[model samples]
Target chain A: MCAAASSPPAANPDRKSNAGATPDPWEACARLEYGGDRSPAWSVREELLATPPEGWPAAETRLLKSLARADATAAGRAFLCQMLALVGSAQSVPALAALLKDVDAVESARYALEAIPGAEASAALREGIAAVSGSAKAGMIGSIAIRGDTSARYLLAGIKGNPSEPAIVREAAGRALEHLATAKA
Target chain B: MPTASTVTRRRFLQQSGVATAVAAAPLILPSGLRGAGAPSRKITVGIVGAGNISDSHFGPLLGDPENVRILAVCDVDRERRDDAAARVNRTYGNQDCKAYGDFRELNRRSDIDTVFVCTPDHWHALVAIDAMRNGKDVYVEKPLTLTIQEGRALVATARKYHRVAQHGTQHRSMKRFHDVAEFVRNQGLGRLDRIECFIPPNNRHVGATWKPEPVPAGLDWDMWLGPAPWRPYTSLGCHYNFRFISDSAYGQVTNWGAHYLDIGQWALDMDASGPVEVEGRGEFPSSGLFTNATKVDFTVRYANGVPMFCRTRFEGGGTVRFVGERGWLDIARNRMSASHNDLLREMQAPGKKIQLPLSNNHHENFFACVRSRQRPIADVELGHRTTTVCNLGQIAMVLGRKLRWDPAKEEFVGDAMANRLRGRAMRSPWALI
Candidate 1:
């Protein structure tokens, strides 16, 4: 039986203190176990979002680094990706796209990338489709279609026609292409 | 010479062809009786989602056995689908009804003419869109899609397939709601000032932490979570309780507000369009598995400057109250009230009666439209527009700021953060489009 999944949980007991004024706690929150207390992290998130537009770069820097931590839980990464989806820019795309390689983290990675509007976001999805396989690849195809990345038209066509690709992936590619065509029409 | 404030009954009737009289005669007779096709030809139906809501649809549909045939029932839960199919079989005194673990199998049956999508919000778009693509008309429950993008896709698919898509925002079919909408549309309220919709909060609650249990014997947990983010099964997170969770549903805002807010759009005569600005505050369970708003206070302003205020009130069921310069009228299930006792009587001094599309029975309306090939009382586009209002308020609550919206483009103005919340990426192998 799989363990129950709930909202993201709390602060990390093993978090190492950084030397600075108002040290960033996002890393600590990102290290918390699945279903741990996330209130402290949510407070920090609120504070970060409440900050003016100029304060986003620093917050994005902290969040992106936390997302890259090998020790961070997949649950934590998913939560961070959600925050980044709201506040992230093109700079956050590569890290997000990289996380698409992690099986557990792939959904959240594509979720964040799907929302961040830019040619780069779609490009990351197109690249992620080639890098990942199975459901992850199919999901990335969906993200590209949602982003309306016409540039991926050839890529999708190739996957859809490839007999080697899994049926699910090929069907997803076909559906994405159909959806994009309908969108164009 | 009547100004905007002084809305004459004749002028109102001229501008909008909706009825303003107080009589309930229009609802007493089912519209299906008049327009329903030949009794010999039955409209075969396959209902997806055999939980509590399925009973509401199947019961009435089964009652019209001569005109409607229950061919199949589908659900991810084995017990529920089997029970629903058994019930249908029992009603017919035969073993003809088939139980399906997956809706796709049922949708593939070329004989089934229409589908009733009573699935959860997250599954609404995927199921309905698939059914339409397979050449089936659909009657989908309220808060049509989980996201604006999904709603757009569903509408496009419906148009492409030429399916008779009826939204289950049944208030549009009820007599009291119709009267209220007609009253407002005919300016019986005298230059509409604002609309107020009161909705209830989440009916169920969950604790801060939960341990996932083993998947139940008869339930397919993965299939149930279709298109939603993968999560381990908690006994409390499945079935009816899915409404409380953010991943699976949008809580009371979409649950109850979808019905009430829909009436506001109808009364405002903005069925094809939506609000231009929205802002709100919400109270969510900060730590619980349930992530949707428990209480929400949001106001959506139309381009015409009529603001529809939706608030969560713990009592009095739910109502859509339209306030105007002259008076106010509030309508709920089986009842309606106005600022003055004689308001209905005064409005009865009608020149030419303004009659809106009349639908007394929502399910029957769907079946009638299935045969007539006309747009139902609650069309998919109207559902999308209403659901858009609910989602905009929800997004505004989440962002905690006022945002500009372009109803035509169906996107937030210069706000990527808000736009991000408009649609979520569906989980793999279940492409939303």
Candidate 2:
């Protein structure tokens, strides 16, 4: 059977209580399965991409609200993040910034923030350097380096010098610094 | 299609310091001293990703002109790497081949002069770039990279290091492909109008959804994922099956497309550049372990007004046909057909022809270039450009729209979303730069 055909509805039970308002487009995302039927979510993404500049706030708001729902599944939120990476603006930064500290959500957050563009996203990644450690911290450092945010050089240098940081994280910071230096060259 | 600048073989060797001793010699070396059996002439190699593709490389490297050495084999799977190491040692009648779970360890070895990056698509750029940066020539498997951005990075790295890099488009080494490419280049078929590339359907059998399975013994699942985003282990997603998954591979589009599209690019003489406009649509597995497109129909229009159409179907024996105003020439593995037999006949005359460099064996060609410091037949720049064609088709398929591409800038024209798709953020601690 088609994987999308067998998927269950979005797990948020409260989402259906609003009968009169425009149907929540993302209600089906919470139960979206990877490597399975994603047409339902893809359709919503197409809608989001087609949104005009003036309507981006509404679309971003809806996705953020769905992402914050207590019952929203991790897979569902990741899907939302994929959409936000495309149409999202500065308004979506804070919600995504919070995800930088989430072990489960940080990867998804990085996926979005890395593509969102602009200074806000770069700042969130810079600040995120302190909020996580180990692999999470190492990953955020990699993202910052890819952005070529020269402002993070001092921050990365400090991490490279600190003895308390794990060797992997320290090595990652050192490598990231080298990458930024090469970019400047 | 940012083509490589014309660097003559003699100039390349001079710049690379390969012929410095000869240039400084009072006279040419005595004939006896110029023997080909010198141990100093050996090209030491390390094979990364000892998976299925490694089989094709081993046969040539192990039984060669007696100068190529397999010093090490690396794979995330312990069993595979150990088996490859054992095979190499057995062939050499010694226990010298090292096995490693991390390619970085292999890349760091100064003794290794070249690396065979046979890893899955996602790991290609990271492994190959690291090898080049460490002064090792590389033979990266076809498709070149998982993303367009990775291919560009690889080309830049090779030029920066002056490393002799070859892409694993072995068809170019075969006489048949070389003949057809030369014929088309010489306009044997008349005015080139269109090129059609027929790809076979996705052959792997996979269900709509996949469930996580136990990490098997001797397999480092995390290492296998490498730069790709983290995911649970599943037998269906590892080994050869990785090609069917979206994260690790781009299905048959890259798996088969890379081979056929490579020939098309060579025939069209567009190795340094590519189509300015592209559009396509494809059918992806709606919900299954196989997320790559199952049905692909895409077209890219070159600046010369010729359009190359790539489509998936069971017919055509999965061939690439160069169509011209007068006739067409079709080519595939051990398969060839032409509108007129006279064209093929005339190509055999071979005098005053736009002949491409010939290498009956791909591995031997790479080793030759490693010592000679000349670009291989399928250099990294050509590999990147061919891969760019595949990646552009994929991006167009996913976006379901036409995209205007700037080959020089290597970006989509005025399309931020499309440009963003050129590359993805490497899963942390694995930056390509």
Whole-model lDDT, model 1: 0.78
> Is model 1 an incorrect, acceptable, medium or high docking prediction?
acceptable
Off by over 4 Å in 2: A1-25, A33-39, A46-57, B1-39, B203-207
Local accuracy by lDDT, each model: 0.78, 0.78
Score residue A73 of candidate 1 by CA lDDT: 81
Clashing pairs in 2: A4-A37, A35-B288, A36-B287, A37-B287, B1-B272, B1-B273, B208-B287, B208-B288
Q: For residue B205, what is the lDDT in candidate 1?
A: 65
Per residue, candidate 2 scores C-alpha lDDT tens digits across A8-83 of 3222222122212224548766566544455556557656644555787798888888888877667787888878
Separate DockQ for every predicted complex: 0.24, 0.23
List per-candidate RMSD values in Å.
8.9, 8.1
Cα displacement (Å) at residue A17, model 2: 30
Query: On residues B350-406, what C-alpha lDDT tens digit does candidate 1 reach at each position?
Result: 453666676656776676666655677888999999999989988877766677899
TM-score of 1: 0.88
Clashes of each: 10, 8
Residue A38 shift from truth in candidate 2, angstroms:
4.2
**Residue A16 C-alpha lDDT in model 2:** 21
